[model samples]
Target: MYKIAVIGLGYVGLPLAHAFASKYEVVGFDIAEWRIEELRKGIDRTLELSEAQVNEAIANKMLFTNKLEEISTRQQLNPKKRISDNVYHSYQIFFEYKESYYPNSNKPNNQ
Candidate 1:
């Protein structure tokens, strides 16, 4: 079976990961070690997926990690195949901040 890697276990990513994990083996990767630990304990601070959902995914053998290298450990199982071949899908979310959104209302002179 192919694997899917969902990077970012935050609001958007966690729900997507849990949904796909229902049918495929998923590797949920995050840069935050605390986030990974929370996930392992079936706690989702984002409140996207319930604790039951988290536990269900773990019971299905879904792997959660904070280490970047851990995401590729599965691909090592099939060195004969391309890394892309082992990973059937990858999903990620990125947020960009705009200074305009938060105008400098607190500027020393303005304040």
Candidate 2:
């Protein structure tokens, strides 16, 4: 099974993680501690996903973690990057994308 890790679990990352959780192992990562807690309780103010959908994702082995080390267990990540001031802030995290696993893919590696 494909292991997936989604960093920056905000509007985009959370939903994407939830979707992937239905098919693969998913781990959601975020810098904010409150975000993790809120998600654990199935709270999404973005109104993108219903409470049922959030809970189902959580039930499907979707772990929300703040510890960046947890991400190493996954093979892939969503291409969703954090946008700050209308520009993509890739500097939020440093990563190396490999072409072997996913050629021409925008998704980043779990490294």
Candidate 3:
């Protein structure tokens, strides 16, 4: 079983994580504790996914967390294997320029 870690559970990352959860073990990591709690409660405030979709991902055994340590443990599961051995996707790069897009907001650019 392949384990996938998605290091941003925003619009792009959340949907991507849910899609991957259907076929692989998925760990959806976000910096926001609120976001983690929302997902765990089957809520997707971003609206990229419906509550049912979030629940389905949970039912599929997807893990959502706000802790980097949790993701680190998953990556370290196969220490001998390189990072490429597992599926790792990160949408955080887009967040770097979020300020420019939002022009004062810290939220990600959904458009």
In candidate 2, stretches whose alpha carbon ends up further than 4 angstroms from where it belongs are 73-111
Pitting candidate 2 against candidate 3, the one with the higher TM-score is 3
* lDDT for each candidate structure: 0.74, 0.71, 0.78
Question: What RMSD, rounded to one decimal, does every model reach?
Answer: 9.0, 12.9, 6.1
Where is model 3 more than 4 Å wrong at Cα? 74-111
For 1-111, candidate 2 gives per-residue lDDT tens digits of 337879888789988998899999988888666668878998876777888988999889899987765765223433463223222234332223344554544322322
Q: Which candidate number would show the highest TM-score if scored against the true structure?
A: 3
- Give per-residue lDDT, candidate 2, residue 42: 89
Deviation in angstroms for 105 in model 3?
Answer: 9.6
Ordering by TM-score: 3, 1, 2
Question: Per-residue lDDT tens digits of candidate 3, residues 1-111?
Answer: 327889889889999999999999899988666679879999888899999999999999999987655665554665666554234333344544664576545333452
Worst 10 residues of 1 by lDDT: 90-99
- Looking at candidate 2, the ten consecutive residues that score lowest on lDDT are 85-94
Clashing residue pairs in candidate 3 are none
Give TM per candidate.
0.64, 0.62, 0.66
